[model samples]
Target: MTFPLLLIPGLNCTERAFVPLLGSLWPLASVTLVNHRRGDSMAAIAGAILAEAPPRFALLGFSMGGYIAFEMLRQAPERVERLCCLATMARPDTAEQAENRRRMIALAEQGRFDQVIGANFPNTVHPDNVDSLELRDLHASMARETGAETYVAQQRAILARPDSRPDLAGIRVPTSVVVGEADMVTGVDGAREIAGGVPGAELTVIAGAGHMVPLEQPDAVGEALAKWLRR
Candidate 1:
């Protein structure tokens, strides 16, 4: 039987975050997009997904979703058949990063999410995509759907996640790390860290892409996933 596949979205992201890749890959596996809006901690978010997931499954997570994926692995390694992380990190939030999340939460509480979105979108896409209407609209719609409360919840969750680097050295499952070469948020360095620690894991960097690598280069991401599945 084909293993179940769980797709986890980033901060303030919904199922639409996987829409681009889903069209091409859904037929190959049972794909479920796990929601991250309800939980205020990584453990809680991972627990929610674990509660709803099948007995054994493959996990594909992007950005903040990747953090939850790591937590899931920590929670139950045997249940994860395969693992993939896109534009994510294994380290806990630095003091500065934690401060930034706190500030974002404060802004959300003050009803300044529009400002938050404006500031965040530029960092989300590559420079070439900064003016792309499709990218802008997609991100705008995602942010709108997520709303301030969800964003705050995700930020808090991310800030509270433990450093996962130590855990990576022990992950025995097939693993892959995908990243955008131009990703500024969680750059190639983060991807390298993950791939380096996970024995025999592959790392793929898509050109001309940024933090939103899955959305920016869906075909490549899909191909990578398909290859991993076939292995």
Candidate 2:
């Protein structure tokens, strides 16, 4: 029997954040999308997820979801059959990153939430994809569905999340790390770092893609994930 698989989307993301890739990967298993609207801290968020998660499953995380994946491994190692992280890093929020989250939160609270996300649109897509109308519309729709308060809560959880460096070396399950070659927000360097630290992990870099690799290059991301799940 094919066991379940759980997909965790990035910050300010909704189920739609993964629609393109989801269609391609649906045949491999019973896939579930994680919803984390109730938790204010990483532990609380992770706990809430695990509370409703299957007893055993494969875990795939993207960006902020990767951090939550790390937390899940720490919280329930035996339950995860395989793990994959895409366009993600294991580093804890640096002072600069934390401050940026704070500023974003302040802006959201001040009713400049649209502006906050608008400013990030540049960094969110591949430079070439920045002008793509379909991608822009999809991102806008997802942002509206996620809304301001959830974004702020996600930022808070991310800011408090643990550094997963120490946890990486301890990973005993099959692991794969995928990143975009041109990702500036998290960078390929962090993906390399994650691959190096996790035992027997494989790394894949999607060319011409940026921070939103899965959305920017869905077919490639889906193929890579397919390979990861096969092993």
Weakest lDDT window of 10 consecutive positions for candidate 2: 21-30
**Residue-wise C-alpha lDDT for candidate 2, range 199-218, written one tens digit per residue:** 99999999889998988888
Q: Write the per-residue lDDT of candidate 1 for residues 27-113, one digit (tens) a residue.
A: 677988887776678888899889989999999889998999999999999999999998999988778878877888898899999
TM of each candidate vs. truth: 0.97, 0.97
Stretches of candidate 1 exceeding 4 Å from the true structure: none
Model 1 error, position 219 (Å): 1.1
Which residues of candidate 2, in runs, are more than 4 Å off? none
lDDT of 1: 0.87
